[model samples]
Target: MSNVTSNSPSASNAVKPLDQGEEAVVRALHRVIHALPRAMDAELLREQGLPLVEYLTLMNLSETPGRRLRMNELAATCGMSLSGMTRVVQKLEAQGFVQRIRCEQDGRGWNAVLTDSGLARLEQAWPTNLAATRKYFLDHLAGLDLEKLAAAMRKIAT
Candidate 1:
C-alpha cells in the first residue's frame, strides 16, 4: 500500500492553484452557505426555545406513524451517531418533548416518541422556521441554481 503524507512534494505538486476569482467565489460561497444557517439557527432557535437539531428531531418524529421511531432509525435519519442521538433524546425526554419506550419486537431496542408538548412546540415553531428558511435560503437562489444545488447536494450526500 502506498502511504500518503500532507507534506509530500508529489502531493503538493499535484494540487492546481486556484485563481483569484475562483478563490473569491469559493470563499464567498463557503461563508454565505455555512454562516447563514448558524446565524439563522441562533436567532430562530433562541426565540423558539429549541436548537435547530432538536427542532429537526421533533419534526422527524412528528412525521412518523404514531410519532414514534426506533432509536437507530432516528439516528440514521438525523445523520447523527447513536450516542449523540441518545444524548439528544435524553434531553428531549427530560424536557417532556419525547419519550423513550422499549421496542415491541426487540427487547434491547428503544423507540423515540414525540409527546403532545413536542407536537405543540413543532406547530408553534413551524411558521418562523418556514419564513427564515425562505428568507435566507430559497428566496436568494434562482430556480435553475436551486435545482443544480440540490442535485449537487444529493450527489455529495450519497
Candidate 2:
C-alpha cells in the first residue's frame, strides 16, 4: 500500500498550494507530459504501424546486452507495470518481434529476447519517433540552455 492514501494525514501533508510561478510551471509541465506522448504515439501509429509502447519495448531490448533483458527489468525500463509489460511482450512475441526464454541463471524468471524482426521494426519507427520528438520537444526548446532545463527535469523527476 502507498502512504498517499486520500484524506489521510500523509496525503494532506503531501498536498500544498502552488505559488503563482510554481503553478505556471506545473501546469505547463503537466500539459506537455500528457500531450507529448499522445502526439508521438499518433505519429508512430500512422507512420510505422506501431504503438508507442511497442516501439519503446523494441528499442529498450535493442540497446541491452544480447538484445535481451529480464522481463521484470524490461517492465521497469519501459516504465510499465509487470502485467502491462507482459501483455505487450506477448503481443511482440506473437508478431515474431521477440521471444521469451528461460533465464539462464534463474530458472524461475524469463527474459525477453529481441529478434531481427524487432530490430527492423525499431528502425522503421526511428525516423518518425525522431521527427515527433523534435517537433514536440527539442524544437520548442530551441535557443535555451538545455542542460539547465534537463537538470531541473531530473530534479523534479527524482
lDDT top scorer: 2
Provide the lowest-lDDT 10-residue window in model 2. Answer: 1-10
Candidate 1 per-residue C-alpha lDDT over 1-158 given as tens digits, one digit per residue, 9 for 90 to 100: 12344776777776666777878877887799788878668867778877887888899999999999999999999889999999999999999999999999968999999999989988988887888888887787755577778998899779
Per-residue accuracy of model 2 over 74-124 as CA lDDT, tens digit each: 999999999999999999999999999999896999999999998998897
Please give each candidate's TM-score. 0.77, 0.87
How many clashes in each structure? Answer: 0, 0
lDDT of each: 0.86, 0.91
Candidate 1 Cα misplacement greater than 4 A, ranges? 1-25
Give candidate 2's error at residue 70 in angstroms. Answer: 0.6
* Candidate 2 accuracy as TM-score: 0.87
